[model samples]
Structure formats: structure tokens, C-alpha cells
Target chain A: MPTIFVYVDQFKGAALSASWETMGAAKKLAGEMGANVTALVFGHNVEGIAKESFAYGADSATLCDDPTLADFRAQPYAALLAKVCADGKPDVVLGPNTTRGRDLFGMAAALLGASAVADGIGLALKDGAVHVTRPAYAGKLLSTVVAKSRRPQMITLRPRAFPKPEAGAGASGSVTKVEPAMKEDDIATKVTGYSVEEGRVNLADARIIVSGGRGVGGPDGFAPVRELAATLGGAVGASRAAVDAGWIPYANQVGQTGRTVSPDLYVACGISGAIQHQAGMRTSKLIVAINKDAEAPIFKLARYGIVGDLFKILPALSAEFKKRLGK
Target chain B: MHVVACIKQTPDTAAKVEVKDGHVTWGDAALVVNPWDEYAVEEALRLKEKHEGKATAICMGPESAKEALKTCLAMGCDEAILISDPALKGSDSTATATVLAAAIRKMGDVDIAVFGKQAIDGDTGFTAVAVAATLGWNALTFLSKIESLDPAGKTIVVERSLEEGKQLCSSKLPAAISVVKDINEPRYPSFMGIRKAAKANVPVWSAADIGVEASQVGAAGSAVTWPEIYPLPAREGSVEILEGSPEEIAAKLADGLIAEKVI
Candidate 1:
């Protein structure tokens, strides 16, 4: 039977929740194709992650534990992954739609001479091929695609697209150790160091995001937006216009050119809701827009909208939220 | 040092994208250099200026894409090339990277290559890495700053902007980098630069010029095939504009959000 391999992505020795989600997806695909599901865990110490993968429904877990594999530097990592995938000759390979996955998967695909699909939301087996559905044109369109003639078809599943699988009744899967085919000398690039942004919630992981746009007016205008976010214990985001205008940093920008976020609740204050901006937050579970112009395009996607001056609405909302939350 | 910056012409962000009869139409939208690529061009020009080297703008698209290359020239690119062929349309990121890598190889002396983090269209953000893979070079993506460069040593250090923080990375020369907006400020075209760009002749190359097979250049070479595409359904509800004073509206909205437990 063909095998399906799930790349277990981790950061700082902690496995990402999306890894389990990918394993869950691979289980379904395995059921449909009668294939065995294997989780490939690589890091400095990934034995625990391998065990966890078994509970998440993998038939086997392959571990490539090495200090050199801790931080993801594409070349050596892709080389090792490509080598493992080649040896296993899996029919399908799955990874998370994340920074590491996006950076590594294509190189692996090229190395294996396989088809690579990005940002896949839906997957299925059809006529001996894995078909995928992905958003195109900035989420304004959905395209169903198939890697018709490729083996070890590669796909990066969007985070949260698949639900996590229930843990198995027992830790029942086998663990195998795979030696990396790459050596230190083969790495052309090195990560010298990292500087973490202290005291801020990552927008991608934030359950609620309070984002602003040109409607925030100027750099100082962000104070009120930050205030509301603080009151609600949510992250602060901005539109490209706001970032470009120097009102906020590009790190906070939420749009097609910026980060793609799918928060449980997204509140937009003063954003006009251009297609570029909408594309980033369209998948949010709930959307609310506050704009002075009732006819603003953002209102079209908003579950709730307040058509009034943001200068008045924002302060009032901040006061109300603070009072209600008692924070 | 020779630098090559890859650029693409995309519909303006304001355009409403529509699909009709399997073709994408963006009504009345002018094709311009991708907004993000402006930073790439700006960074390339900066590097060229600092090193006293030549920077060339390269693109793969229809004849109209030359306009985008001209804009690059106007922004101070020393020369430009347009890789155009009928067989090259609808190319996926991998195929696009293949053609671009071939073109860069044909250039023969590109010490560094620059690209935007991602184009507004397609938005795959993988071409730089794919190109680097094709060339067996390092790809330093999401770079926020070009911290240092050693031309003689053929090494460059860059600061990469990640979701949580910044990472300092170093790579050898002959590296492909995809830069973010924080790298530099893009300058507007000057009158002299505009005149020079307008009068300059841009050389156009076909698939054969790059030594790529027809089947490996366009849709035929793509790994993924789009079987169906349509606009996302419009949100079904009308905007229920709160009709009250600011305090009343705020109270009502807060109550509603709290009731829904989405606050």
C-alpha cells in the first residue's frame, strides 16, 4: 500500500498544533486510499513528539533527532527531508502551511520531481490522484487542482482547516530512527541569532484581533486602537495603508501583502475593507467593521457594522468594553 | 557585482477581480509593478549604488510587462530584459522559477538576486526559494534589512522579519533574497530617468532563448491544474447600521458581541 507522510513541525522543542491537524488529515486520506500513515519528526529532541504523533493516529513515527535540525535552515533540512521521502517513496507528503513549510516544501518537491500544492484547504483522492482545493486571487476565488502525474504529491495544508484527530486508545505505533543524509558542510545558510518581539501576542495565534486602517488617521491614532485591544485582551493589527502611512509598523499589517490571519473574532476600526485587506481576514470566524462611511466595502463582509465616525465610535466602544469586562 | 531583480506586472490592488469564461478580468485596472516589488527594486538599486555595480530588472510576462521593466529602469536599473513567449502564460510558481533561473544563468554573472516577499497576485511567495533551489544557492527570504555586505568575501548578512521576531542570517554571494517593505524606501521616477526609460529599447527573449522546452514553460509545465475557479459568494446579510448616539451604539455593540461570546 502507498504511504502518507506527515511532517511534524515544531518550534523550540514544542510541536505545533497544526502538526496534529496534518496527521488527522493524513489519517482520513489514508483511510480512503488504504495507505499507512507515518509522521516524520525532526528536531533536537523529538522523541516525545513522535510518541504524540502515534496517539494522533499515525501508524508509525520516524525520528531524525539532531541538534543541527533544531532551527529550520532550508537547505540542509530540505536535503534531509527529500532524502527520507525518496527512501520511503510515499505517495503523498503533507506539511503545515506555515513559514517553515512554505520555505521547505517547494525545494523538497523539486528535489523529488514531484508536484507541490500550497495553502490547500480541501484534499481527496480521485482517480489515483490527490486533488486539492486552494484559494486564488486573494481568496476571491477557490481553485480545485490535481497533481495528475506526480508521485509523492506534496501539499501544505492551511492551519485550522482540519480538525485534530482523537487520541488513540493506546500508544500503539512503532518508532523508527532515520539518519539524515545531509552534513553540516552542505548547509549554505546559517541562522546567526533571533530577536523575539517581547510582550505582544502573535496575531496569527490571537483569538481576537483589533485592527485599524487609514481611518486611524496618524501614528498617534493607534493609541485608541491599542487601548481597545488591551481592554479585550486581543492583539492589534493594521491595514497596509496604516502601515505604509507610518501609523504603525509593517509587522502589524493584516492584508494580502502582509500576514494571513484567521482569528475567532476580528474587529476592524476605520478600515475600508479593500479586497487586499479583506483577503487576509476573510476566513475569520466573526467580522465586525466600524467605519464613518456606511457604503464602505468592508461593511459587505462584516457580520456587524457601525456606520459612524470612528473617532467617536472607538473611544465609546473602548469605554464600554472596559466597563463591561471590568479590566 | 551584478544584481538582477525580478519584477512582475500585476493589476492594481483596487481592481475588482472577476472570472468570466475561464479568464480573469480586472476592469479598468492598470498593470503596474507589484506593490511589494517596489521595495525589491529599491533595495537592489541601493546595493548597486553602494557597490558601484550594475543592476538589471528582469521580468517574464506579455509585452505589456515591459512597462513594468521601464518603471524599474526609471527607478535606476541600468538595464532590463523581458522574457516573453506565448507558451509562458499561466505558469505556476515552479515553472516561473524555472524560466527565471534559466534567464539568470543566461545572464552568467549575477552575484545577487532580489525579489519581493510575494506578489499581490498568485501570492505564493515561493519563487525566490524555488529559484534558489534551482540554482543551488541560498534563499534568505522575508528580509527586513541588509545589515552588511562584503563584496570581496562574497558574503551578505540580512535580518529576516518573522511572525514573532527578527532573525539574523548570513549567506554567501550568489544568493537569492526576497525582501520585505521595511528594507528601504522606494523612490519615485525622476523626469530624466523617465525620459531615459521611455526611449530605451528592452530586449525580449522567447522560451528558446532561455533554453526551456515549450512543455516546461507554461501551463503544460505546471504541477497543479486549476479545474474550477469562481468568485467567493458575497456575504449574505445587509449591514445593520446601528441607529443611535455614540454611547448608545457602543453599548449595543458591546452587548451584542458579549452575548455572542465573540468579544
Candidate 2:
């Protein structure tokens, strides 16, 4: 029987929500392959996360605790993960297809000489080997790939691609402590510090997103966009044009060249839907576009479209949502 | 100092994509350098200019990919190399990275390697880190700013853009770094440079030429197999356009969304 190890990623001492989603994918694939699932958590003094992994259907958990592992330095993390994979000799490894996952898993795959499939949206088993379906050409095409290499097929599941398994109360599992094989000189990268921008919700984690585009006019134009987002208890986003025009920061840009967002609801204001932008938000559950041009491309992809001046529409919508939601 | 920047030829960002015969076909779409890699090329040129080094453009693809290398050359890359092999069809990220790493080794004396955050086609963003690992070099990604570099000390510092914020990181020399668009604005290919690149003979290498085993490259070496190729799912239902005064339309849209419990 094959054993699967899923990395439980943490940010700022908290478990990334995508980690559970990855567990959901691993559990499904494990069932298909008749495999066992083990969760791997790494950090400084993160024993609690190892226990929490059990609630998400992990049969076992491993924790690697060290002061050097405190921050997410890529070299040390990759070295430590390579050591764990070498020691565990698992048949498969799963991780969330995020920034850190992309960096860590690639190095891990190279070290283990395993097959790597990053940004996997679909997983299945065929003839005792795993097959992954991932997007290519900027989500214009889906490519199903089967790794024909040795054991320990490593893959990173796209964020929110799989349903996050509900945590079970009092779920039981075993925990193991693994000694890392990292030398002090092996770490070539050091994270000196981090500074999180204040007063902004993460676009990836937001349930609703209100986005602006070039039509937002200027820096001050984001006021209404923010107001609508606030009224909806959501986050704010910007099109690459607005970002490039210096109207907003790149952190809020959503598109092929920017961040990919799959919010429950996406409200596009003054944005003409370019294929580049659509690639990022096409997976959203609902799309609403408000553009001045009646024939803008955004209407084709929007479930609800309103053609008008966004300056007049956005504020009104914000007010209406506030009155209707009574919040 | 010597740096290598890897580039890929991809369908333009706005091009319409289609799949035929279980394969992706570009269909008259202009082939251009991958948009993300533009930053990598830009950063490479800037670094070479600052450090008085040479930047070579390396790529693995069909012969047509030479067009992308030409663009890199036109953008001030000192030299261009293309890794092309008949046996290299359908190579995955691992195989491609393996080829790049081997090519870099053959070139020798590479102090730094650069790439974009992700290719616009695969959007995998795996090659840079994988290549770094394969070369036994450090990897840094999403770099927004290159603060300082002490080539003599073999140390470099940069700010990496994360979801939450920017992180200050330092890495050793002989590092592979992927740049975000904010790192630099890519310059357009000059007419003279384009003329030179068009006439420049980019050296092409096969699997054997790079000293890589055939089985370790192309489809045979790739772990992932693309069994099927298909278009994305179509959006369901029809769009409903609400028209009225801004206030009235807003009110109706809110009520409708509320009634559907989608807000």
C-alpha cells in the first residue's frame, strides 16, 4: 500500500486554509489508490498543528521543530523536506499550489528524483500511478498528465480547487517527531523581516471582491470600489491596467499577470473583461460587471451586467447593499 | 559576472486558444516571449548592465522557439542558445528544467540565473526553482526589488512580494531568482537590435549534445503525461442586463441578488 504525505503550510504561526483543501484532495486520491494519508507540519514550536492535522482526516502526523525553521526560508525548508521525504519514502506527497508550495515542492521533487505536477486541479489513479489534470495556456486548456517515473509522485493542488474537508471533533491520529538533517551552512537564504500592509483583506481569502479597472480614472477613484467592497463585507481588487497606471498597488491586481482569485462573488467595476483578467476570475461562483460601454467584453462573462457610468453606479450599489443587508 | 535568463515562446496573452487532435494549437496567434519572462529578461539586462556581466538567453522548445530567443537578443541579451531535440516533444517542467540546467553547466561560469514568476502558458512557475535545485544553487522567487549585491562576498539581498506583504530576503551567489513584473519595465526590441537578432545564429543543442540521456528528457523522461487536452468549461445561464436610473438599477440588482442569496 502506498503512503501519502501532505505538507501542512503555515503563515505567521497559523495554518493556511489551503492546507485543509489539500487534505481533501489527498483523502480522495488516497481512497482511489488505497493509500494511507500522513500530514507533515514544519515550523518552530508548531506541535499544535501536528495535532490539528488529525481533525482533517490525516491518519498520522509528523512535526519538525527547530529555531532555524521559524521563518519560511526556501533553502532550509526544501532541505528539511527533502530529508523527510528521503526518510519517509512515501509513494506520494501533496501540497497546496501556492507561492511557498511552488518553491518548496519543485526543490523537493528535484532532490527526490520524483515526478512533479504543480497547480493540479484534478487527480485520479490509473494502473497504480497518479494522473493530474492542470490548466495550461492561462486556463485556456486543461492538460491531463500522468507521471511515468518512480514512487513519491509530488504535486501541489491549486488553492480552493478541492473542497476543504470539515474538521471532525475528537478525531484521532498519531504524531511523530522527525529530526531534520539540515546543516547550518546548507541554508543559503535568510528572511530578514516581513511587513504586511495594513487595512486590506487578502483577496485570495475573501468571500466577495469588488474590483476596479482603468475606468476607475485615478488613485482617488478607488473610494467607491472600496465602499462597495466594505458594504458587501468583502475585499477590493484592481485590474492590471489600474495597477500599471499607478492607481492601486499590485497586491490587489487580479488577472493572468497578477493574482488569481476565486471568490464567491466578484463585482467588476469599470473593467473591460480581457481574456487575461477572465483567466483569473472565471472560476468565481458569480460575476457582476458594471461598465460604461454596453458592448464591453465583460458582459459576456458576467451573470449580471449593468451598462452605465460606474461613478454613478458604484456608490448607489454600495448604499443599496447597506440598506438591504442592514449592516 | 555571467547570468542566464530562460525564456519560452507562448501565444500572446490576448490570443484565442484552441485544442485540436488532442493538442494545443496556436492558430495564427502571434508567438511572443512569455509575458512573465519579460520581467526576467528585463532584470537580467539590468543586472548585466550594473555588474558589467554577460546575459545569455536560453530556451527549450521547437525550432520556432528561436523567435522568442531573438526577442531576448533584441532586448540586449548578449547571446542566445536554444535547446531543441526531436525527442523532446511534450517535455514536462522536470525534463525542461533538466535540459536548462545541463545547458547552463555546458556554458560554464554562470554566476546567476533568472526567470519569470510563471510562464503564461503552463502557468506552472516550476522551472526556476527546479533548475536551481538541479544545479545545486539557491532559489529566490517573486523578487520585487534587488537591493544590493556583493559579487566578491557572494551575497545578494532583495524584497520578495508575498500575499500579505513584502519580505526582505538575502541569498548567496549562484542563485536562481524569478522576478515579478514590478521588478522592472521591459524595453521594446530596438530596430537595430532586431536586425542583429534576426541575423544572429542561435546555437541549438539536442539531448545528446547537452550530455543528457534520451530517457531522461522529453516524454520518456517526463513523469506527467497529458492524456487529454480540452477547453475550459463554458459559463452556464444567460446574462441579465439591468437598466434604469443608477439608484433604481442598484436597488433592483441588490434585491435580485438578495432574493437569490448570492450577495
* Docking quality class, candidate 2: medium
**Model 1: per-residue Cα lDDT over A1-327, one tens digit each:** 889999988877888887888999999999999999999998887799899888998899889998778788888778888899889999999998877888888777876667888888889789988889888777767778887666778899988778777878677788999887677777777789999978877786677999999998998888888988888899999999999888888889898878888887898999999888998889887788999887899988888898888888888988998899886
TM-score of model 2 vs. true structure:
0.97
Q: Which stretches of candidate 1 lie over 4 Å from their true place?
A: A165-172, A309-327, B243-251, B258-263
Candidate 1 lDDT over B207-243, as tens digits, reads 9999999998689888777787878777676666676
- lDDT of each prediction vs. the true structure? 0.87, 0.89
Candidate 2 residue lDDT tens string, A1-327: 789999999987788889999998999988987889999999988999998999999999988988788888777788888888888899889998878999999888887788888888888888888888988888778888777776688899888778889999999888998876676577888889988888778787777999999888999999999999999999999998999999998889899998888887899999999988998888888899999898989888888999988999998998888888887
Give per-residue CA lDDT, model 2, range B1-263, as digits (tens). Answer: 89899989889998998988877887898999999999999999998999998999999999999999999999999999999998888788888899999999998899899999989888878899999999999999999999998777889999999877899988899999999988988999999999999999999998999999989888888887778889988899878999999999998898778876778
Best by TM-score: 2
